[model samples]
Target: MDQGGAPPVFSVTAEGDDDRVHVAVTGEVDMATADTMFQTALREPTRALTLDLRAVTFFDSAAIHAVVRLSQRFPATLTVLPSAQVRRVLEVSGLGEQDWLAGR
Candidate 1:
């Protein structure tokens, strides 16, 4: 679902079994939609969560914070399919190459 914000924030549905939630995130994720992302991740009762960010075009600090927060809270295995731009941001933010950010 694309959460309408100051900018268009987009994300995908995460249907879960007992152990995973799958959300394919696209477009941009900024402050306005950061909370929504966290909420969606937390709502899942799963050990594995996949955030496919292959289609994401943009994101900011707030989005980074949300990712970190979810990493800490859920302990869900997170698969981040970041595009080059988003990956650069994550790398700069110190979360890109970490084991925690690696889903497998």
Candidate 2:
């Protein structure tokens, strides 16, 4: 939600086999909606977690914070496929250079 009207249209889906969890997200994510992404992405423990953000058009600091927390909680267990927009943000925020998000 953007806090001015109806909640933003955010969709997150996590699906994978026993050894991994694959997550996909579509839509904007700001302060009001970052928790949804975080909670959904970390719903269960797995040997690995992959986050696909190719459909995401916007993400704010809150979204980055959620990713930081998720990584801190799961350590060395996340792979991210970010859209150009997302990559820009992540690069500006310095997370783009993080090893966990590398080579995606």
Candidate 3:
């Protein structure tokens, strides 16, 4: 969730396979969308997650925190495929090329 109780809704295009989920987020991921996306990942038993952020031009710490927390939950097994903007956020937040991202 970002702020104002607006949780991120998934525009999930394809069905997940082999514990690998392909997600395309198309909105702001501030505090509002944080936990929604986080739970979407955490609740899944997927071994790998590829988040396509091509449509996400805006993101925030809470969103990054969600990813980082999920990465920790998976123990360096989170596979993130983010856009440049999201990549920058991850990098600046000290999550770029970490063990988790390294596996992707």
Best by TM-score: 2
Top candidate (lDDT): 2
**What would the TM-score be for candidate 3 when compared with the true structure?**
0.71
Clashes of each: 0, 0, 9
* Candidate 1 global CA lDDT score: 0.74
Candidate 2 per-residue lDDT over residues 1-104, each given as its tens digit? 35777544788889987678988898887898899999988787778888888888899999999888878876787788888888999999887788677554
How many backbone collisions does model 2 have?
0
RMSD of 1: 4.6
Each model's lDDT:
0.74, 0.83, 0.69
| Residue pairs whose backbone atoms clash in candidate 2 | none
Per-residue lDDT of 63-103 in model 3, one digit per residue for the tens? 88887777777765556667678878888877776765533
Against the true structure, candidate 2 has what lDDT? 0.83
What are the per-residue Cα lDDT tens digits for candidate 1 across 63-88? 89888777776664666667787888
By lDDT: ranked, best first:
2, 1, 3
Query: In model 1, what is the error at residue 51, expressed in angstroms?
Result: 1.3
lDDT of 3 at 70: 72
lDDT of 3 at 14: 31
TM-score of each: 0.79, 0.84, 0.71
